[model samples]
Target: MASPSVPTSPPGPSPSPSANPEGFCALSPDDPAYRVFIDSLDYLTPEEVERVKAAVRFSDKAHEHQTRLSGEAYITHPLSVAGAIVEWHMDADAICAALLHDVLEDTGVTKAELVEHFGQGVADLVDGLSKLDKIEFASHQEAQAENFRKMLLAMARDLRVVLIKLADRHHNLQTMAAVRPDKRRRIARETLEIYAPIANRLGLNKMFRELQDTSFRLIHPMRAQVLAKAMQAARGNRKELLSRILESIRAKMDEVGILAQVFGREKSLYSIYSKMEEKQLSFSQVLDIYGFRVVVKDIPTCYLALGALHALYKPVPGKFKDYIAIPKANGYQSLHTTLIGPYGTPVEVQIRTEAMHHVAQEGVAAHWLYKDAEHSGADLQIRTHKWLQSLLEMQGADSSEFFENVKIDLFPDEVYVFTPKGKILALPQGATPVDMAYAIHTDVGNCCIAARINHELVPLRTELKNGDVVEIVTAAHANPNPAWLAYVKTGRARSKIRHFLRTVQNEESAALGERLLNQELHNLGVQPAEIPAAAWERLVKASGNRSIKDVFTDIGLGKRLAAVAARRLLAEDAIPIAATPGSLTIRGTEGMAIQLAKCCQPIPGDPIIGSIKKGQGLVVHTHDCPVIRKSRSHEPHKWIDVEWEPSPGALFEVRIDVEVKNARGVLAQVATAISDSGSNIEHVSMEGDPERLFTRLHFTIQVGGRSHLAQVMRNLRLIPHVVRIHRTRLEMEP
Candidate 1:
């Protein structure tokens, strides 16, 4: 174990890419590659250095007979990857891990043998980096997704895993020219979508920028070449303008009594191209292609430099941000401002302390690289750890959900808002009050009924803005409304809400299934209390379910019919269908388990009949409903005779389609008609031929039963300009 010496800050400007546009590629051992790797380990203890040397020797020996597609020794690939880790000044274990990352996947090396030779730390890192190729997958996408999930989960546990993986990907991308054209495009797409974003989030700006440019070259070579040439031309033309801006900022800083390091940095080609495409602008219109960073001695000096720069030129309103007051989630802190420079050009500038500059560039890796950066770097590590832990918390989420969450985290264009208690909370842009509540806590989200933004009552879906103070209003009885899913921005909020809805739905379905199964059994003269254990087991076995409850749940969910399950569990000819028929008692309290068919909403006096849905419990339909008429011919055996009880209990929903003249007050008038008839409109929809003067308005109204609905319909027919008023009986609209 060794605490490596801190590396000095890298130079301000990037070298010309035209010299080696493919970026870093593997070098032969006869060249400076091995020496460079060895020199990078100078900070390691002698013992640790010996361990790394052993890993390098083992990897070289294992790959002695292999060669890369570029006709270079295979060992050079891992050597190059290890060189990257060493450059990052990673610890001895990470260095060793980088050296042997490909051994397990590409060679005949076993994890057990690696553990015995290199110790568990190195072995575990290699294992995490290994792709799961032994297992079979149905498609390439499936295998890719599963492996990505595996890699991400491992990275969540050990940040070094992803660091090593990123290094591996970096080298692979650097040498992508040797890969087949089609395969190169696939790898480039994955790099652009996944690896590049991960590097950006970790604050590995160098890798992030390189990966993007490399992938852009591989996937769209012509476009990348054109952009590169354009950038080169722009560099020549803008050199004097940039020089003037830098000189002005330096003079202004001197006057303000602030000592700083000011330098101009060009945006990466991919970055510039992305901005142009996003804004639908030409290259000339992209004014912020070149930005300046002013590294001051301390935090106070950063603001002083910013003020000096702002005073030198006209500041672009709303383009100034103080990240020092509210750092980014990645722990980057700086003061960013855009000013109209020498020729009315928008010049973007960032001001930060020297330490902030390092953290901004190196991100979490700075913690291990720079001893002096430990405090701020550790703060970033803590933040990163918390976010990773959130990913682990969502481990039970399905693959699609987990992958979607990772994508959501990839691009965090955040808005910083204040809570009522003065604590700041960061949320994605377009986040609403419900998203705010969920970000606070799941319980708070579940109970949230209303919200007050900036001390004024606001709708839950109101999008929050930066600096707005948000206060959530919760109620004891309030629960998550499914409508919240439409506006929530965070994956956590969406997942939690979906989990709740799914759990509630399952429970309701299971309860309904139990009630239906019991009623069907009773119809066969088998009382619920009298059912034997063997019968339950038999039913479970026949349905291929794990337990009796699962069978009930499936039946209730409309995947199975209760009568069929009951018949399977009963003895042959135990009771005739007409012999001991028992009636199903109805109560509106059935919730989601039992449902009244919306196609023909049946009321107490509507002569109702039950149809055993495969997964859904009994669906009660009016006897003459057209849905029943159509389904009876195809599924006659599923139909069950039923009658509503004297006390139907609770409100019944019925659909009414009204044809009305396209007048402004027609909707209001129809709503008034239903309201005045003692019926509540649950939902409303209006649509019709735009060329015609009449429109079709459909309403789902709540009432006591069929008689109540009839009266409401009669009252609607009497309204002026109401051409036709009729109940819609089709289960689903055509």
Candidate 2:
């Protein structure tokens, strides 16, 4: 059920300011504003009012000896915050929670006390509103990030938590004049970067604009003052222009027999300044500073008013937006257009029904503050719930990753695109097909390999634009590639990809580590499968690892060494065998934990040696590899004997440089020869100039072994245009 709406009738007189010894609010309780605050609460039931009074009385006691930087009683701060929530006509629990939000954080009171007095609902709200105390962070950024995470997690549980928090922040911003100058600037910047965007996404346009303007004023006082003066000066000069435009739109609406309310609207100073800075324009170059909103009685009349305005003034092409048809993700709906006004100046106009106007201005709060006769609060609540759920799903991420994703979500300048079924999907501006696929379904996103945009097949990284129809082509066996993380824009896609990669990488590393450990154990005449459970448990404790698998996984990932583990395990055997020379073998099943050195690509046909770098697992190098020569001079003990298993299963990378005559199709011919030799060229680059009658071509090809690479080179040398060919090794020349 929806919360009660604000009553339309004016309330009776409230108690005077003298009613409380400590201040009831930042302003005198007798002030007209404080009276309006209490009067708005008259709609609440008597029991609810009593609960609110109890909370206020308790908080007033808790903060009895405390005062704010402005010299007002600390209790007055929570009173103002509660007053703001009251203006929104929030439920009694919200108002009560707002009153006691800081009690548990700043006073001797506890959460249990709040629960005993106001119930668990109000206690949870207050706890959610309170900051984490007694925690020391290495940096302020870390502290802020953690604090935001805590609040968001609470909000995910109860939406009221954020509602009260936003109100609290709003009041704090209002009273920021009393804060230290440096601290004020820091808070204002954070409010603009974090809170303002959050308010905007929540459809709190009033709060969003107020936060932006207030933050901008503190962050750049001189710039804000200059912009304000410039706007005032322009208002005087364009007085007649704006007046005529409003009159003309009003007359046009009247001619169409549409009952409308029209008024001149000036863009906020910060908004104008942002536009100027973004577009790199001077004050005079920004033309959309003057605008008007026309609120009609119903939806049909909204379109009619738009038509009337268009008939009277020519609209700037491509500047018209029909948000009414495709409401924004925040449930905002309006028809916006920029028209060529009198004297060829541009004037922006918005047309929406009365209900739309309220929703556009008040956002989520409008459902409660206004009756919302057409739509219930459930609609906005559901959308907010979905958004919060996504945030909660991201809990698997660390603080930094979660914070980064939240910041990305805060600025969703959405683009509306169509699915193959013609269903419109709204995504952020730079969202790619990967993000779109993920939005459809998690499975579809994980298996997506290609996309079709406007019926043309394109790479998955292709960015989607508004109005484009996109279709994802998925393969059942396909999995997410690490490269996709670079282009995917949405938080869901990014988080999902990272989560999948982390899981897969761990599993694979563990498996590879197990094999390496087994080999090491076998060398010491110990069968891995026959190891005692007690022995494994003891080893786990000795290694300070969570489990036997974690020990192997870390070793496989080059974080530890299987040899060290094997020595430790064998040390308990009481029987030792002489070290077996050249015992370990490679079967190419080690996954990413074991890598073939790119300097001298080792294949089955080449003698190879393994070097266990500190953090990089076994690196295989050719026995005669120059890199081994350089390494052997230092940590020769790290080098170990390793032989390629008979019939290696995976392909190895080998570079070949071909000197060929510069001619058309020559590069293609070389590529075809390599392909005919049953090798795939992974990369190609040209070095020598074509105009010099010859060019040097470098090809990095995937081959089975040395024989396969030799076959590829022989095939290339058969070409009549080929001058010379040689295998390329990354070795420094003396």
Candidate 3:
């Protein structure tokens, strides 16, 4: 692809140089920082350079009165960010956006002004990097989450926005010492939790390590200091050993007629700290603190180098991974192996082509840095684009939920699995077949009924392992189950499932709500179809709802009372009769619109009442339930008469308490008896002291109704060791 270009322009007037007593340079053309920033743009065409200079001048003018906490001119921060962008070989527009990024948020400059001076592309990039500071939020966390969501969505549209934002965060972290102690810690925590992980996800290893180490130092200064000292001492002790290993690998590669560039790699302090923390190991126990990277001419040479190294030292079994064949989800490719070094210390080695090395360090940025078709980061770009597109899929979620899902996606310790057709799919560790189905497509996920691993039927919740052949069996009528949410590991799967469920719930709730409202209107001597549009407009306005459907949804979700809504929809003088409303019939298929109360376990043929709960829809309870009896007196308006349809569509779960003798086979006998009675045990728990001769076994079982429950109790009582058996009712204080 051809590179982006910009128009040439003459330089604008320069501000006079000034300096503080502490030697901080003011905004000026003569500033050393500005000169260095200009020098770094050497890769850009002269015309592009001039355009970037224009942005610098504009930013300098806009931030003339502002200064950073470090006492330097505020323009220096943007200049530093732009310098990083230049180093990454970003196009002229990206550089300009970097210079003007803070102007929209920190100064009086508007996006319109940016567009007038620069271009819409530059203005959009700057706007994307800006925070939503002008809007009100419920808390600081919400504000931050919202700002992050905005930036990520913007990044989905233009990847340069994140590149510029990451550079901005990098500069801020570099000068964080001037910030207050508490503020520094907070910024460091956010950086470690969000930004660093994002950098890693984008395959920006160089930036990722720097961000992680800097944040670690700021967050835990003492621990960082101690770890630094230890690493330094360890480095000195291992220098000679690393040198010997490097020489041996080089000599072996030469003997095998393979050309390679070998160098020792030092582990970052944050990496060491994380290893120690995660593995519960002492400093000395952390092996492979130093490793080697072998960059060769081609893919074949990479494998040859790996073989040469293994021949020099005994290879550690189960410590080798060939990522070149199945690259990581982030598109990192290499061959890695651990070996016993000269003194038996474990030494890790990585083998890859020179092009892979550049990608391993620069990640997606390599697309700009290395434009050659062979060396370009096209694979990484494609992977990144797909992930960015998923951000759009997750847009309808709340800010906090979106932020959380993105965080989960950023940390993918992946396992590579195969489809039946031989295509490979990478998923997070502990991911289930549902995650795989979703990764394929949202429609596939919605219709997946079961999965077969290697042609053997397996549970949909089974955790996928490396090299497993996962074939999802989808049916047109199948739908995602709420229970799948408990085991699905990928954020894509989780968000997709939630979005589908929410969509279904809204539709179901609206239908149920309309029915309830219509029943109420009938009792009030009004027909829903006969209600005028003017009345609906008034009802929507009075209820603070956006539309008639919204009002119905509120009533369905129990946020608004259907009776009150029905009265509001009628003309003021229209109500004349005061008749009792008929009980609403529930067949237990209301989906999210109606929930069966666990406290009472009301089944078919039971006298049930419905309680409207905010955000939770209607909850059904047996009329004699202790919880209902206690709360009915306090909130009579929320209770509505409900009746069961002659044939309820689903089984009801009921709890039974069985006291049994402490015998080896007594629990099994009781379970078998309940099974013989045609009841399915949902859960069973043993309570009371084990030493007692008698213990209570609580069995939560699914039954058809009260008759089936009675049969189950009788069967359990027939067990020889059963002391007593009865249906259980749990009561809660009002």
Give me the candidate number with maximum lDDT.
3
User: What are the runs in model 1 whose C-alpha is more than 4 Å off?
Assistant: 1-31, 61-66, 532-548, 558-592, 595-632, 635-648, 659-670, 682-698, 717-723, 730-734
What tens digits encode model 1's per-residue C-alpha lDDT throughout 619-715? 8877788766878888887776676677866788777889998887888889998999999999999898768799999898998977888889888
lDDT of 3 by residue, 1-734 (tens): 21322222233222223212222224667778888888888887887787787788778777888999989889888889998988888888888889889998998999877776676778888899999999999999999999999999999988888888888899899999789999999999999999988888888889999999999999999999999999899989888888888898888988999878888999999999999999999999998889999888888888878878888999999999999998887778899999999989999999998788888887888778876524448778778889899988998899998998888788648998999999999899988999999999999999999999999999998999989999999999988999998888888998999999988887878887887898788777777789888989999999998888888888888888987888777846467655777788888767888988888788887789998788878889998899778689988988988998887757888888898888888888988998899889999998866578889999899998877888888777777889888777779622
After superposition, candidate 3 runs with Cα above 4 Å error:
1-25, 372-375, 541-547, 573-577, 659-678, 686-695, 710-724
The most accurate candidate by TM-score is 3
Candidate 2 residue runs with Cα over 4 Å from true position: 1-36, 136-138, 178-182, 373-376, 540-547, 563-578, 581-603, 606-642, 659-673, 689-695, 715-726, 729-734
Error of 1 at 684 (Å): 5.3
List TM-scores for all candidates, in order. 0.88, 0.88, 0.93
**RMSD from true fold, candidate 2:** 4.9
